[model samples]
Target: MTANETIHPTAPATEIDASCKLPLLALLVGASIWLVIGSVLAMIAAIKFHAPDFLGACPLLTYGRVAAAANDALVYGFCLPASLAVIIWVFARLSQTVYALPLVPVVAAHIWHLGVFVGIASILLGNSTGFAWLEFPRGGSILILVAFVLIAIPTAATFGFRRDRTLYPSHWFLLAALLWFPWSYASANIFLVSMPVRGVAQGVIDLWFGNNLLFVWFSLVGLGVAFYFLPKLTGRPLYSYFYAQYVFWTLVLFGTWCGIPAGSPFPAWIPTLSNFAGYLLIVPVLGVLIITVKTLAGAPVTSSSDPTVAYFIAGLIAFIISGITLHLVAHNDQLARITEFTWFGQAQTQLQIFGFLAMILFGALYYILPRVLGFDFIFPKVTRAHFWFNLLGSVALVIPLAIAGYEQGSHAYNLDAALPALRVSSMGLLLILIGNLLFAGNVLAMFLSWKITLVKSIFSAVTSPLKAVEVKS
Candidate 1:
């Protein structure tokens, strides 16, 4: 097919449509709920940073546990399921086939959520593993792994049975992510739990796993959505299909190696390798930026009325900014100055997860929801509200945290001087909380409108029968 040739739209078979709709909706609902919950928890955590005594009386709401729970909920609970929904939809669309074993993904989503719920509960109950991303207890981790497999099975089958002979860039990225996540999750769990690494090696593994999960899994999924939607929405072909290959491999090979140096007692070469990987990542970032800019050339810089286009552009810009920030902070001198005991690292995390990945997913959901539901959004204003809230909230959140981190780092010796920065960061978190509330409200409105329509249809069906009988009499 020529570069500009759009994929032919195929009408999904009735059975296929029926099977996929509920599961996709379920994933969406689950993700939105988790987003709100995570936001609340995060707000509490951020507040505690400045006001340490706000909820210090409650053991269950301790800062450490609450922070861990919030992170876990946002990552596994919101982003994972949301990304899966997008991936499954894109896969089915590209394959020109209906999803098989629809119930499997739905069941798996429930199981995954259950696992996260239990894990967070465990953390609150003081059973956390204390291993950063692997804070979940062994049992919860096992449950998640199993759930992942269940979700992956149907995903693989969909790709395997694809009708189209040619694969798209989105397909490659999505497939790689699906494969990478399981490997990374299982490997990390094994090293951290099943067999258990020793001493500084544990830290090495932990950092490696965290970095890989962010770059290899989450970043890839976000990029894949961008690749598909950018061209589709703009009515343009990818600028260079061949360069997309370079973007993919560079990220897969080098991205996995770019872990934060933990000052561990391991061999010196490990940190060196990671630093080198971090610098090398600039290659893929630039490649993606070039492709995106070229593809979007001649398009409006921002379409305020179009949430999807606006969000996509915002996400792409954030991705580039985060990339540059990461490259700078990964340098040896910068790492010593900012990577640890500061909010700098947290800022980077927020930029990547919320700014880039979540924004792209939001755009994808806005695009996909209408297509699947077969109706226009009931509250277009709410959609616009969500976009503005997210964009403004992210800016309000990251900038202060980054400034605070730098100030706090520079004044490391004077604990009293850092208070102002902490308070400023707290204000940023408050904005994030407000933004999240808007998002949750928007999602709830969409579902409520759908439910109202369903109820009206059912009532009409029942009443029409009586009217027909009366007319006959």
Candidate 2:
């Protein structure tokens, strides 16, 4: 093939280095384990509402325990590792650097995974602070911080040692996310643990950290993956690089202070600042939408075959949907009537967790998995099953929760009987259980197939009889 044909001049996937695949593999394994465990706990937590009498007596298996474990696993277990995988890939690609020693990244991943194990265990033991998403025990938080620093070290080093002289729009998003995590985490730790902010300042710091978690950690990482995979999948250079650039810049600048899902009750300045910045998210949202549309406008046929593309596309839609919902939900008065520690809050989290982050991770895995395993997916049927189970299960689980939440919140707001409100919400909890079962089955099937294939290959190398028996079947 000519140099132009060989290099895949238009699409960006052609040049992806194979050596960068291992770190991604380790990360995905961690994510998959977490995803399965997290979703199951989420369902268990949801179900306990209806059958409060079911495991209510068990301290370790209590509703609070499961809820904390579920959210903690989802955040630290799935999202963090998965996003790091994307970061590894993007850093390698933009750096035009191959992994001279892949073991370093792998070691970093092991450290992160260890921290996740400790955090989940700590939370499940009822050592949490009862905070949403930041519920990991103090000891767990320290371990997680150490893990974060370890992972960030290689990323920062990659940036400094990069081959690509000019940074891409995606690079800005990645860097911003890396920076935001430490800032938000540190502030949250200080406020929630170290000094313990007093009165409204506590609420203010809580709002700041929560908003930062959503905008910077989840959205920034999601957007970064989108920025990379969308153009790469469409087989086009980024469309209107300037617009993409503007989107990245605006998001980092204005998306910082908008996390008052229950709205702020502080000084006028607090709410004003948060609300104003929340509205400003539109600048980046609209800008990126235009860029994505332009990039995918005339893509190659190969785009359809690429799971990465599909996943990236799904995440982009989720990001926009969540962004808009965030605005609608940020009204303190409106949320005051709706956010009564109910599933309504969990619904938005699901959108951010499963809808935005998980989808992107799926895309990242779709591309990274086959490359690392030295094979195409062992079974397309299993792959499709995994995707559908997660997609539908998330909707099935989240939608009913949202409905139940609204019912509970509306009733509570009007001073109705709490028991009746709880009873009504119980139905949604049942649906979540069914959804989790389906999702867990799908994940098990996918991993089992891979395991079988690997085992079969190993035996076949020793004797053709093993292969012949399989062929006969």
Candidate 3:
């Protein structure tokens, strides 16, 4: 085991065992493939809705099924596993113990991925119960839940058994995210799928789960990665433990109860509960933002050197934008009407996925792959291509959708109008299709490049002249 210095000036340095970084690469490849597939489905749904004649009347390609599949692939297939890759790395780094049982994580990853496959298949086949996010049939839901339990429990156990008693801010966020899933998943499933919670309770549970998934799962992963990389990039400890703690508790307390109070029949108190939480989130968002600003306040050189840090910073900005919009929508019913359906929601989702999640993962891959494969990015041009294609496509897809959503919602609230809003919305839908296609192309190129490079290395005589050697560092 090699000892590594703690970034914090006050904390003692710790040692990390020599562990094979296999699962990290494997999970990343798996997630990337899924993202490509998910993006294709997204484009298909966008096209089908915009042009009914494009796909004819194929039952398999129905708008609803495709849309559901898109969400399923993105959530279950890509985001969760990618985030888990980061989690595993964090656990290993924090623990500084050699990978005791790497195969366990591999097994966990396989079970979870399989569960996602079944869940998506069920949804596509119209076996869904039609609840947002919880649309997987009971049978599928059970499998997915079992997978979640299998993965999450061990992850938590690993964290609990770590020798490091002094927890980092990133650890706090990661642990919270891990704990949050089981609770959120169980609550939503129990209400929407099992016995059923009627009326407002159902809506409340749904909103609760949705918001928690974003904050606890997605947001935590983003923040944890940021926490790790930012320090590593700057070669300094975080500017303030005080600030991070404030943000952490504020996010935890507020994140759990956010996302309710829009025209639902649920008791006024439910949204009121969420509204208070939403408002409180502003403190953490601003506090964390300030901490970020202070920490990197003078480190532009470092930031430029690390695209992952840049992506993370951008994601935080996006998250703040989403957080503010969420707060406003939760409080004012009229504003919610306008912003709720508008491209605003679309913007939020895109910002979180692309600006935050995708960028962080890309940066992580860039940082990790070299070590794992003992080589630099095979083609820097391809990396740039991936970044720009996805970046521009994301902006193009999300902006129109947000604007279109606003137009549709405004028209709906004002006069008896469906056709006019639908017409405008169609334009936004078209943009989404174009953006998705571009993203798909970008991802496809990445995979092809990865595959070709590996093949060339295996048979160098027929491929490039560059020698291929196993990474031994």
Candidate 4:
């Protein structure tokens, strides 16, 4: 094929990137609102750990309910939709096609947001299933699932009908994640809700679903965004396309198995399989880290000046650290000592979800929003502040929790020492709340700026013709 034909098999009919602008904005806005709500719930839950009597009067804000609501809000409400938006955009760009059936995703986004709202409300009302991430009731879960399918269909079609035949690394990650989530989600719901798994198997299913949700869905989306943006932003090609393939396949093959060891009260071999899989994951994790370093070897690391680059790099490091931590904690020795029924598990969750996945989303938004909206950030300082607060807040949140977890685990036989550790972790939660407040503030500022600019433009457009007529008269 000629070069021209290879590059442009089919010219785009419309600006593919701009087609989903409204939907993307809506998703981001909804996600930001949920981020704040989740932060508040998290703070309340954290406080209750140390000061059980603080909000003891309100049953709705009880520790268990609030914690479940917080997790639901962050995972389903904020991260899921935000990641979907990013993936959709990436798919559209790579396919060189406008988002087919654009209104479907827009409507689906609203429904998904409503579903999350109702789901959180259900949890707060004491209707929680007590499952890890599958806390949403069956009805709510099905609603979100249907809405997700609506969104995913068009994305899949875009991939299928792409202008280019060869796929990028990001494309593979995006496609795999989008496909994996629905199956995993449906299976979890079916096992946990529709046809209940027997005693020990229920826990196994829950752990499997929850961990896969993290590794396969959230982590994959983060890595996909990193693959697309890191090289683009730095004006460099990936260090090794071959290594990228290795990273993708390894994650796909091994990611699901790593979650099996999460204290499934099953037979010994089950945990052994999980531990071995977790150890094997180091190969891909190290490959990703090496690729990142080599790709940005000479590139100046300016996360401070460029929030997107900064967050991406921070997330990459977090991913590596989380991987190593997962491997170590999965070991039989460490699992027996540190993991079961301790804050250490929570620490790992926060590190992976917030430090790694959410950070990448933050960076993706920083880079994507302006281009999609056709404007620069109105308040650059707010963006920078958001980054710093998040960085510091995540560090504060994870480190204290890790320390507290170690202490709690070491003294598992002692209850008195655990209380003090809980208090220390609560302080970290306070920092996280503060950081989330900063993020909310930044998002609000951006929205207000956009609204103000839009109103001014409309006003000018309306009056311009009248002024022209007046000058003519």
Candidate 5:
């Protein structure tokens, strides 16, 4: 057998881990790098939200471009890759099989980053297509599609090669995610950008794409991670595991139809149906909450100082809140009018993207990275700081923005409530920036620590042979 095949051959799980280590590291490191870039741009965008003239001098840093660039970087660069890394790792573990060609994911990771860079650069250079999430130009979008398909194909192949054919909930969710993204993304690009939809139809398609990619693609992976970790970390089997099927089905089926803008120019029934679907989403959202609480109820894992618990707990709660917000917002026209085109809507997106999805990824990384690196975390101290910084920062952004929305809406554009809201949100953006920096720093520190350890081992091996020969002489 080749040396590669023998890698931790005695343990099936270790072999899978060994096979995935390099790809996981590469994807995760790229994700962290993009996190810093996104956070910087996000801060800039948040500043411009109220100030508007903060970077007025620079065309490249215009509010539209900067905000769009930040959104793309966070969604495509950081969140997508980070989520993909977790999906890949969890899928492999569930399959109970080692990768036959690990290089597939490593190469795909590089190409994916390249595509994200291209998309962000295109947006900055005034080439944005002006679609919400499908802003990437044709070239960047195509690159992402191709790269994603490369990974998607392998994901399906891996399923066929699994040692365990009985699927877990995580497996089901991952499979759905693998299928959903490419379809939704390609359809959006085609209808919104490439072929071009006319009038309100374009808006409808864009909303459809954005909502699916979030509620379906991102949510699937995030919940898959949550479901896997909640049980695994607590050393308990998932309570009501059967209900997970209901959660997954409801999300994919109902969640897809729920995002039609409340005031969309479409037929009244369309919007009404969407509102009904939004209300139906309560089932799965509550299911996830119940499952998580029951799984971790009375478990000592919650009390641990690992920082992962903080992220997990925060992410799960935020998800519930975000979902509840969506459900009611759709049913209430008055509330929708208040929120539509307001910072309150943005706040909810942040809660879902940053507070729930990104936090889940953060927790997963805290657990996954150490295992992939084959070492316990060397600098565990700053992780707690990382959690607090991000948590507080996210709160600062969400709460004030929601208030700002209310102030602007309730007061008929009066600046009374907007004033304090802007100030506090700006401060929140700064905290978010700091948290991203700390996360990047920790990832780098861990990588460097691993490299140094590897180098010392190699040096000691070389010197030990020389010393033995000299002693023999």
Candidate 6:
């Protein structure tokens, strides 16, 4: 690849990078800024579990508020925008077209981040809607929905104008994600926020939205990313290509019916039905694991040198672990009795979001950003550190929480048991805080490096004419 190929390449893949460069860069930069914000709040929320007085004086920093704010920031601010950016790039590349209506995403990026900021602020300020993922007030939720639609235009356009007719495995996932989120999000707002579902049905609707956003979107976008990049980075054809459709169909079929806890006040039949669907989901999870493992089996040793590979594998492991954990808790009556509403559930969430989803996105960003920015990573070594801290921090956080939750449950939620569990989970929280600091600092470093390079290029361009005039004179 020549310099031109890196920045202005005619090849379809690099062309895709160029076509969507400006919009995608904006989204990622926004995502990074939010990650730092959300990570700090999450750490604060975790600490309050063990040390209630950590920020006791400030009503604004209460555990409930901090946790909700953190969840909103990470999900809407970081994950959604970053995920949409990935979809845009993949869709364009696969469709073999320069992305159209790029301005829509650029505008959408501003609106989306604004919505996230306002929503998070609302939660911290005690104006949250009190719905799980829909804690954002009506105004914030509406803005977010509008912004999402705007950002999606280029994706829809690319697919419509595609030069390529045959769909790849990833196309199914990305396309499904593209079509699903808008309907799901819009309907949730209509049923839950705007009109308000009567009584218990509100909870059902919220769970439907939240679970779909978590599982369906993750399966579609996150796994879509893995499907594309794993074989790509490793230089191998995808293994078990035939099963790709099965994984897609099963997860899409069942993911929304998950997340209703056992022994909920809702009708017994509802929880039973949801749990059954959750158990069946293991089939798709195992399918993803098998195909991914087969592809990585004989992968060249040098592929691991990429650093992103480590993140990918760690995320895959986390995904499988979380999936199996979900299946077991749903299947075993005794296990649900012990773990329901405990830190065990929270552990499962962290594994799915930070461990599985975030790690996979981190890997994707590391690969995509350089091509879009037209520069090599300034601190390649930082990624190595990032990987270790990320892996260790997630392990420290999830494992301890799971044990704590179980111990707390075993002892029937006694203060003595709670105290010990809190202490253990707090240690994990501290490790996660350190890891987030590294991530934030590295993002800052990368930004500075890119800016410095940009300034030098401009300064040299401005001075070249004067140098030529002096030589000629």
- Please give each candidate's TM-score: 0.92, 0.82, 0.83, 0.91, 0.92, 0.92
> Please, what are the lDDT tens digits per residue for candidate 2 over residues 1-473?
21112332222433445666656666667776787788678767766655676677878788878888988887888788888877877776666666445666677777778778887887777777766767776777777777677777777777777654677777888888888787788788878887786776777776677767865678778887777777666667777779977887787787787765433467787777777777777788788678777877877646356655766776777787777666556544576457557667667787788777887777776666565455666454555555555566556555655666777687764423334544544444344344444444543455566678779998888776543335544
Q: lDDT values of the candidates?
A: 0.80, 0.69, 0.66, 0.80, 0.81, 0.80
Query: Model 6: per-residue lDDT, tens digit, 1-473?
Result: 21112343234676677788778866877888888788889888877766789997998999999999988888888888989988888777666678888888988988888888889999999999998988999778888888888887778888788775667788888888888888998898899878887999998888888888876787688888888888777777777668888888888887778888778889898898999988898998898889888989998747445778777888888888887887888788899999877789778877877888888888887787778767767776676777777788788888888887888788887656656655666666566566666666665667678778789999999877664445554
lDDT tens digits, residue span 94-159, model 5: 666775567888898888999999999999999999999898999899988887887777667766
Question: In candidate 2, residue 173 scores what lDDT?
Answer: 81
Per-residue lDDT for 1-473 in model 1, tens only? 22423355354543344456766777778778888888889999988866889889999999999999999888888888889988888787777788878889989888888888888899889999989888999878888888888888898898898877788888889998888888988998899888997777888889898988766687799889898888877777787778899999998988899866645467988987887888888888898899988988986655543558778888888888887776776655665565466777788788877789889998988877766666666765667777787888788778777776777678763446565766776666666667666666666677778788899999999777554335554
- Tell me, by lDDT, which candidate is best: 5
Candidate 2: what lDDT?
Answer: 0.69
Candidate 3 local lDDT, 316-432, one digit each (tens): 676666666666676667877677645566566766676667667666655655554444554554555555555555556555556666666777643223334434544543443
Worst 10-residue lDDT window for candidate 1 reads 1-10
User: Tell me, what's the RMSD of every candidate?
Assistant: 3.3, 6.5, 6.4, 3.9, 4.5, 3.8
Q: Tell me the lDDT of model 2 at 148.
A: 73
Which of 5 and 6 is ahead in lDDT? 5
Query: Candidate 4's error at 104, in angstroms?
Result: 1.0
Tell me the spans in candidate 2 whose CA falls farther than 4 Å from its real position. Answer: 1-18, 261-265, 300-304, 331-342, 412-473
